[model samples]
Target: MQIIIINGPNLNLLGKREPEVYGHQTFEDYFEQLKTTCSDVELHYFQSNHEGALIDKLHEVGFSYDGIVVNLAGYTHTSVALADAIAAIPAPVVEVHISNIHAREAFRHHTYTGAKCKGIISGLGLKGYEFAVKYLQEL
Candidate 1:
């Protein structure tokens, strides 16, 4: 099966940005481990700090990939455009959040993209990606 992981904004700073919330390991290291652990699956990753770029990527892979695991970060609350992109896609999308947004600021509690996703995995850290991939695999 084929799957894509798409992360938005500030997430590229994974290891260094906020160790307490996101953990000390960079996504690159974790991604390598994931690739090795799920060797039978073809996994691809893309991260962008730009909203339009993320939407473009979603549109690009939305139809062809078997599944998509997306972490839209702040866009989750603010971007109707991103949500629209998700709604337009054919591939099932699983929204992930390393930290529990509901427990954070009040504004973070709402997600514009969640309603469009097939599922959501929140506060599970990087493991959320693994769960999302497995869920898609099962489907």
Candidate 2:
């Protein structure tokens, strides 16, 4: 199986940004863990603060990849175009949120992209990425 994890916006600051809410581990470190544990699958990752770049990536892998795990971060609540990109894609997407959106601000509680995903994994930290891949593998 093959899977790609897509992240958006300030995610590049994972380890430094909000250590309390997002944990001290950088996503790069967590990604290495994912690659180590999920060696059986061909896994890839892409992150961009730019919305257009993220959309382009979705389009690039939308048809060819087995599955996609996405954490649109702030874009999850906004970006109708991003949601549309997911909806338009053939690949199954599992939306992930390191911090539980429901437990946070009211604005974070809803996701336009989540509505288009096959399922959603929230509040599980980086473990959610693994779970999303596992779910996609089952499908």
Candidate 3:
């Protein structure tokens, strides 16, 4: 199956940004682990600090992908456009979060994308991506 993993905003700073919350692993390390776990699946990964770039890629590969796993970073609590793009896609989206938004700040509790996603995985750090991939494989 073809699975697309998309990350947004400050996720590029995974290892250095906030080690306590996001973990010590870099995004590259996380990607390698995902690749190892889902070796049989065709995984395509993309990350961007720009919201429009992520949205554009989502639209570009939406039809071709079997499933989408997104860690939308700060965009989860904001960005209706991102949510709209996910909703427009034919593939099932699983929203992943490194930290538990509900326990962090009141503003972080709301997710514009979660409502449209097939399911959500939060507060699990980088392992959430693997869980999402496994879930997609089961589906």
Question: Which of the numbered candidates is closest to the native, going by highest TM-score?
Answer: 2
Residue-wise C-alpha lDDT for candidate 1, range 1-139, written one tens digit per residue: 8999999999999999989989998988999999998888999999999999999999999999999999999999999999999999999999999998888999999999998999889998899989989998998
Query: Which regions of candidate 1 fall more than 4 Å away from where they truly are?
Result: none
1-139: candidate 3 lDDT, tens digit per residue? 9999999999989899879887888988879877988899999889999999999999998888999999888888889999999999898999999888888989999999999999999888788889999999899
- Candidate ranking (lDDT, best to worst): 2, 1, 3
Candidates in order have lDDT scores of 0.94, 0.95, 0.91
Pairs of residues at least 3 apart in sequence or in different chains that clash in candidate 2: none
Return the clash pairs for model 1, or none. none
TM-scores of the candidates in the order shown? 0.98, 0.98, 0.97
Candidate 1 displacement at residue 8 in angstroms: 0.3
Candidate 3 TM-score versus the reference: 0.97
lDDT per residue (tens digit) for residues 100-121 in model 2: 8999999999899999999999
Which ranges in model 2 have alpha carbons more than 4 Å from their true place? none
RMSD, every candidate, angstroms = 0.7, 0.6, 0.8
